[model samples]
Target: MADQQDELRALLKDSGEPTLERAIAKAREMVDRLDNVTLNIAVTGETGAGKSKFVNAIRGLQDTDEGAAPTGVTETTMEPTMYLHPTMPNVNFWDLPGIGTPKFKAETYMKDVKYQNYDFFIIVSAGRFKENDMILAKEIKKKKKNFYFVRTKTDLDVTQEAKKGETEEQTLQKIRKDCVENVRTLGSPSVFLITSENLARFDFQELVNNLERDLPDNKKYALVMSLPVYSKESLEKKYNTFKKAAWAVAFASGGIAAAPVPGLSTACDVAMVVPFLIKCYYSFGLDDGSLEKLSKRVNKPILEEVKKSSLVSAIADKSSLATKIAAKLAVAGVVESVCSLMPGAGSIAAAGISFVTTRSVLLEGVKELHRVAEKVIEMAELK
Candidate 1:
């Protein structure tokens, strides 16, 4: 009770509103925005610059994945094709047509692609940064949007240089220096060296960090939540974001009584709790498809390893069972069943549970998911 009160008070303070009703409205708005905010990222470059692969990677899909952006040495994208994130449909990555061709001027290309639609732009280069890439950066700058220079296929360079007796670090530093010097005229914009096959390697993390730093709070939240949990650092960051969000969810669910039950209103609380945890489960890469993808990528039976967790199994099972029932009953039943099955979820029954009890249950679910996610990261050797 005291903890809920403290959270409510903090929420009210953050809301900057004097009245409880207004504060609650603001809180609900914040939660809604966090869940439904639209983030559009633009990826543009010359033909065969690995832009399509980068688009697929940012959306957590492989080139061969069902809805992955088409990749080839030939120019595959003819228009601005918007690929929605598999889980987060609101976050879209626009694969724009390549610039610097005989017909497409950099300035004209920006206008043709509708530059105003995206939150930011990423100009990719497979080898040396070209003059057209710099021109596009300046055009994006004039439009008042952020643009990043990404040099892809760094892994190939490292592999080829190894045979020449050049250290990986030496090769990386030389490439970075060369990329920087090439773009020195553009105020020495940072160039991220990356390989689509493995986003955890090279400058991908640095690129994500820069995006997180520069994006607006809501868009950044969407970006973070939508990204694949590839490393311990990323998993921990996602966990902390969920941890911070727990209070808002608790307040939102606890305050809104959806239906009048015998002892308490569990419907709305369950409604919010179930989906939030499910999103966490998917975001942590605990879902079947994501696990299968990871297993194939790393050649490890990761799905079987993660399924060993009782909590994970419970969540996955309950999520499967949930789709058959109506929304309220689905989550409500799942809550009770999960609590009964998983020792980590505590001993709270779904019936006759008050707001505080519901909040506690939700927190327990989040913690259990976090633990399973951490274990998966360790087992997969993702750091």
Candidate 2:
């Protein structure tokens, strides 16, 4: 109980998970289930700016044509269209209709689109960032939130311009500068050039990296883990974060020690925790691009975490082996009452401590997950 109290205090310090005592008690009850997390992305731009296409690209969806909120010359999307995360169902991309078309008033337009629900905004444009974009950028900045400019259709535009006889170097340089210059109109704009057709081109990797880097450690870790592996660096970074997050989750779940039943701690994890992690990923903005990439790397179908009961089962089964032992050792108070308790072993308490405890067992699991992800990342190189 004392051990559980300590862990609860630690996990609840900044967790915002109600209260530590109640949380633990509740967690103990949820060993068989999981929770939820939600991430929201907003796409907005003038009509014909390819916001919908960009959304589809980031999501690894085929095309944003028909039944996809429309991506043509005319403003096919009259009102905000919300696309649920193809993989992580809880996460969503809000296509906040077109804003640069005629008669766009910032305040009313934002209201019409229900702007408050989004976690961040991506203002996309095909040609150049416009005055309407800058005005909204200013408003977003003033609101103390985040926004990114996605220069859509970079593949077509750059290819056409370069084919007109400009050297590849000159064409690339001109386009880069042009995008930068256009975004400069808005205060502190970081432009990401991308093509919905081929996310491998332009700055899709850069954009994803920046988004992860700009967040807090936990958030960055969550975001990175949820995203697909675009490069070796991305794979490695995500592995590092996943390892860290796994450790953190273990650290938080350590309080399972307080539960009276030997494996009852399992219930706390299955119910309150494992779900919390999946939810955390969603809330951290899990999407199809990330899941699809993860699937490709893992060589398995990637479903939204919400639909991943099999994953929960796997986690429970895998973790049960370790947690049952941890709880048993805790119940026995094997550490304090031992220096000579390990039959004939020296520093028996230390030896037992080395084997049990949240940090040690969890460290092994984290390493295993990392190893698997790294191997998968390596395999992708060949394919």
What is the number of backbone collisions in each predicted candidate, taken in the order shown? 0, 18
Clashing pairs in 1: none
**All models, RMSD in angstroms:** 5.5, 8.5
lDDT of each: 0.75, 0.55
Q: Which ten contiguous residues of candidate 2 have the minimum total lDDT? A: 347-356
Alpha-carbon error at 30 in model 2, in Å?
17
What TM-score would each prediction reach against the true structure?
0.85, 0.63
Tens digit of per-residue lDDT, candidate 1, span 73-138: 576447688898888778899888778665566658778888888999999999988888888888
Candidate 2 local distance difference test against the native: 0.55
Q: After superposition, how far is residue 334 of candidate 1 from its true place, in Å?
A: 14
Best by lDDT: 1
